[model samples]
Target: MAAQTETVQWKLGEQLYQNPLSGEHDVSDFIMEGQAAISFPQRRMRMENVLDPKLGQQANFVFWCPVEFPDSIAISWDFWPIREPGLCMTFFSAKGANGEDLFDPSLAERTGIYPQYHHSDIHAYHVSYFRRKEADERSFHTCNLRKSYGLHLVAQGGDPIPSVQDAAGPYRIQLLKWKDEIVFKINDMIVFQWHDDGTAYGKRLEGGKIGFRQLAPMIGEYANLSIHALERG
Candidate 1:
């Protein structure tokens, strides 16, 4: 028999969710952790942790998308900072440590706490794009990329988005992961780029789920969430 090469079709990635962030979407559409609330304050999906800011760490919460995405995909969304002095993080490539589905009943239940996702049962890569939550973060603005199962700060770069006072935006944020390289950009300006050498934190993480996390008291509004595939080289 003659040897043949395999051919594959490449198309723009299938959109997982393009929510208007409006009230029309059901609350049942997402998996919630802690005390996160979704309200269409102005017909756009606005998420804010109901826990008081003074609650500090306990005030943090996460909202996970109902879909699992492939590795070589581009995750993009529009963000507006409604209230400041809060932190924002997006967790992706997440799954149970034992290779089980993220929602497998056998896994430990998640309660919107930080440790549950990082120290306990799940493994993921979370990026903080707008980090004005603390005194130090306000003085120095930067975007961070972290891999977890343990908090390993792999990359850091400047954050260009202005504070809520001077902001007039539905800022475009994008994170692109192709093979071992991950790049983050805001408004087309490259923030940080890192290549996983596969020696640290086991190996390059593969496909998993994505979630939105916020440190309470910071009301952030998001819309037009999407994921698209890149042509693999």
Candidate 2:
């Protein structure tokens, strides 16, 4: 007999029984480098930097999910870029350095700074898309995949999301990971794919949490977050 797998989903629209942007969902679940806000506007979960724009690089934050997921699964969500001048990143397969629960109070607190996630307490794979935050990024857009606990850029590809001014969308974004292979796509168009070498970037990450991070002065909306178990070959 084979192990049975199940799929979990969060229909983040306004009709959800539970508040997607509330404390129950671990909205304030992680530490922050600066102030950010979460709200349900127009039936979608919206995230934005609320601190003074002067904070600049200091105004970034990450919101983590309350539950941990299995290693092999497909994660998909809808994204809408409302305001720019910021970046968006998704962290998956994240766990404490000591294999402790991510929400374990005993673990060192996370303050949303870049180093804390990429060099300190946790290990995970992060993918950044819609890279319109900086001047160089705007001139040549691309999506990047990195393994963390020491920020290693594993892969990269062209970014297809347009700038805010001309954007009209609820773009469908999908991240499919199974064992050591990961693939990212936007609107069904493949952006990047990579097979983890396993030993090089520390041990392969498995069974952990996922998180949404944003740089200051940018606002983004999200909905229909879903996770599905993938059968092994």
Per residue, candidate 1 scores C-alpha lDDT tens digits across 1-233 of 11112222234466655655566554467888788778887777788887777877788889888787887888888889999888899998889987788898999988777888889988898999779988999889999998888888888988999999988888999888776777787997778877777777767788898999988788998887778875554
Quality of model 1 by C-alpha lDDT: 0.81
Model 2 per-residue lDDT at 98: 84
lDDT of each: 0.81, 0.77
TM-score of each: 0.90, 0.85
Where does candidate 1 have its weakest 10-residue lDDT segment?
Answer: 1-10
Runs with alpha carbons beyond 4 Å of true place in candidate 1? 1-17
* Per-residue lDDT of 231 in model 2: 52
Model 1 pairs whose backbones collide: 21-44, 21-45
Note the residue pairs that clash in candidate 2.
none
RMSD of each: 6.7, 6.5
